[model samples]
Structures are given as C-alpha cells and as structure tokens.
Target: MYRIGEFSKICRVPVSALRYYSDLGLLPPESIDPESGYRYYSAGQLPRLNRILALKDLGLSLEEISAILDEDLPAGELRGMLRLKRAEIGQRVSEEQARLARVENRLRMIESEDRMPDQEIVLKELEDVPVVSIREVLSNPQDVGMLIADGYSALMPAGIMPIGACFSIYHDPEFDPTALDVEIAYPVAETVTDVPDTPGGRSFERRVVRGGRAAVTIHQGPYDMIDQVYTRIGKWISDHELQIAGEPQEAYLTAPDDPGGPVTEIRFPVA
Candidate 1:
C-alpha cells in the first residue's frame, strides 16, 4: 500500500488528480486511515487508474469515463470507441491541412490580381460513362448542393455506391445563374439497374454521358468564383480555334463540405 503522494509518484499522476478521481468515485483509494483519513492506494488499483487515464487521453469526458468504468464496458466496445475517435482525429487533421492550403492559395491570388495567372487547360478524349442521375430546374443556384446531397441519399436506399466522382451537367444553352438546368449524377457500374427516385419527385435514371473531346481545367476555390475559370477556358478554346459542341460538365474532385472548398474539374466539349 502507498500513501496518496507515494501512489501519485508511482503512477506518475498528480496527487490532486488522484484526489479528484477519488471524489468522483472513478479511482477511489483501496484504504483510508480511520483517524486521519489519509488515502492509501494499492498496486492492484494500477490497472483501473491506467484505464481511466487512457480513456481521458482519448478525449472521453469525465462523465463518460465514469460511466464506462462503473459499467465495466467490454474490452471490444472500448476498442471500437477508440477506433472511432482515431478516425475523427485523422479527419480533423486532414481538414486543417486543407484549410491551410486554401489560405496560401488565396494569398497568391490576391497578390497576382493585376495579371491573369497561367491556367493550365488540357484537351482529352473522355469516354462514355453510365450514371444514375437527377435532373432539376432549380430557381436558386445555392440549392444545387442540396439537390446533389438528396440524389446521394436516394441512392443509399437502393444500395448503390458511386463508382466515381459526382458530377453535374449544365444542360442550358447559356449560363443562367438564377435558373439552372442541372443534372446531378453519380457514375455507377454498367450492370447497375432499377435506379431510385429522389424525394422531390425526380427520378434517378440511367444515362450514358456521351464521349467526346473536351477542354478541361481544374478550378480550386469557392463555386461563386468558378465563372472566372470558365472564362479562361473559353478564351483558351477560342485561341485554339475550337468550337463548343456540347453542354458543360463539372465534376467535384473534393467533397462539397471539404474545408479547403470544393475542387471542381470543369469540362467543355469542343470540336
């Protein structure tokens, strides 16, 4: 048996922490002096103390730790919780890194405001892909994200996972910010059939995105500023004496909720 201070030294935990744990009934001492009330812990309590410290380090709240300890949570359950916390931390770190990159890009854009930075445009022959899609005429452009999310939700019930990136095809002959004729699509396996319908009464139909030569440019930043990249791509197409042949498409490379902003690849079919 060791006194509170001695046990603190042995466990490498502060005396105050030990006392607090004791008060919370999380790691009470094995014995206490009848007259002076001096707390004494035994080596046997080391395992319990270690568990409490471990859970706390994993970002478990004190109340949650107490419940877990008192309930004697199964080792497998505890391990599952740890795994979830690990994944959450990893996602947070990735988001922060992306945000830092966005900040740096923003600074560069601000510095080069006087001149148009060289935007790389690539001409590639795209292949036809079968997709499940939802077409809608949205009055407000902001609802486009929501529409895409709804399309995904509709697919979940049908056990359909997107095989490739989510993309939207602009069907309107000209750009209309107020009214968009957009088709939100997810590429799926050719064998997929019986697609689901969205809650908004739009059916998710299987369609082949026709293969063609296209001028593609990757735009990184907010969607509101995407028009600038489109302008640049248009200029590049004209400079190369190419004619726009079909509807435009934008594929989301990064998730819509990504911290760095949505990274979109814009494709304009050309001849």
Candidate 2:
C-alpha cells in the first residue's frame, strides 16, 4: 500500500485531486489510518485512477466520470459515451475555428481603422411589426433580391397589405457569401391567415419582428458592397462595449433591381 502522496506520484495526479476524488467517492483509498487520519491506496486502484485521468483528458466532468466508473458500465455503454464525447469535441473544434476567424477579422478591422466609413449611426427603439416571412437557404447572396420580389408577388395575390419596406433577417451565425440562410419578410398591419407559396416555392409564415434598442445605419449603393457597412457596425458595437441582443434586420429602402440606387437601412439589436 502506498500513502496518498506516493500514490499521487505513481498516478501522476495531484495530491489535491486524489483527495477530491476520494471525497467524491471516485477513488477512495483502500484504507485510512484511524489515528493519524492518513489515506493509503492499493496498487490495484492504479487502473481506476488511470481511467479517470483518461476520461478527464477527454473533457468529461468529474461527476460524469464518477458515475461512469462507479456503475461498472458495460463495454457497449462505454463505447457509446466515448463516441458522444468525440462528437462533442468535434463541435467544439468547429466553434473554436469560427471564433479564431472572428478574432482575425477583428484584427483586420483594427488595421483598416483609418479607412472606416463615416456613415451616421444612430441608436433608436424600433417598434415591433408583424410580418409575413419566407425563409430559404440560398447558394449565393445575389438571389436575395429575386426571392424578396417573389415573396411580395405571392403576398400581393393573397391581399396582404404591406405597411413598410420589406426587410430580411439573417439567420446564419456568421455571414457567408457562398451560402446563406435568410428570411425575407414584409411588414403587415392586418392579421392574415393564408400561407402563400413564394416564388422560390416556399410557404410564408407570419411572425413578429421584435423591436428594441438597435444601432441603425444606412448604406446607399449596391448590395455587394454591404459587407463594409456590416464590418463598420460590428466595430462600432464593439467600440461602445455593447452586446448584440438579437438577429440583424436589413430594410430595403429602394427597388432591388433599380440601377438608379437602392438604399438599405441595417438595424442590429444591442443591449
């Protein structure tokens, strides 16, 4: 039998961690000295300690590891748990990759701070509006205009009265030019029940566009150059130490196909 300190050295685990495991009934010592209150572990417990360390390296919590070890789980159950852990790790890796990309993008924004647009950005409370929306996945951003037109045409036939400019809600966690998930919606005053088929062969559903504190900005020009506006707003939000509270909305203020000009107002909810 080895004392707790000696056992810790053998297992390459910290003395405090061993005591914690013992306290949690995960790796109790084989015997405890009644007089001195010392903890002693047997060589046989080394395998269990190794298992705990291995699972910890896989990002399993102590409580989960304790349950897994204490239950003497079957081989199939153990394999399934490991598989789930593997998938979770994969998802974490993807999230970290995205985070790294965002950090790099922020760095680029800082480098280009000199050329940032001087567009007027304002904070305002946008009132809630009811909308009939058609959500679809697009292979490219250029399809947004056609999809919005189709939505309007479908809604017009259904006698849906539009109150204001049509807007779109970006659903993708990050902006992707190659593939996008967006909801094109038109504000309506009257409650309508008919779900009209969009030009893209999708059904429109009624939903409320939540309103709150929003950082609003206008971009006048083509839609292709809108990324610059987005980058500017994102930088402004960060500069003010504000948190994005909800999804972004882009209200089209001009005709989508008009060569004259298409002005767009971008609103990002902030807290």
| Candidate 2 residue lDDT tens string, 145-216 | 889889888888777878899999999889887889999989987566667787667888888888999999
* Candidate 1 residue 183 C-alpha distance from true site, Å: 0.8
Name the 10 consecutive residues with the lowest summed lDDT in model 1: 101-110
Clashing residue pairs in candidate 1 (N, C-alpha, C atoms within 3 angstroms): none
Question: TM-score of each candidate?
Answer: 0.56, 0.55
Model 1, 201-227: lDDT tens per residue? 789889999979999989887779888
The list of candidate 1 runs beyond 4 A from truth reads 1-118
Candidate 2 collision pairs: none
**Clash count per candidate:** 0, 0
lDDT (C-alpha) at residue 259 in model 1: 88
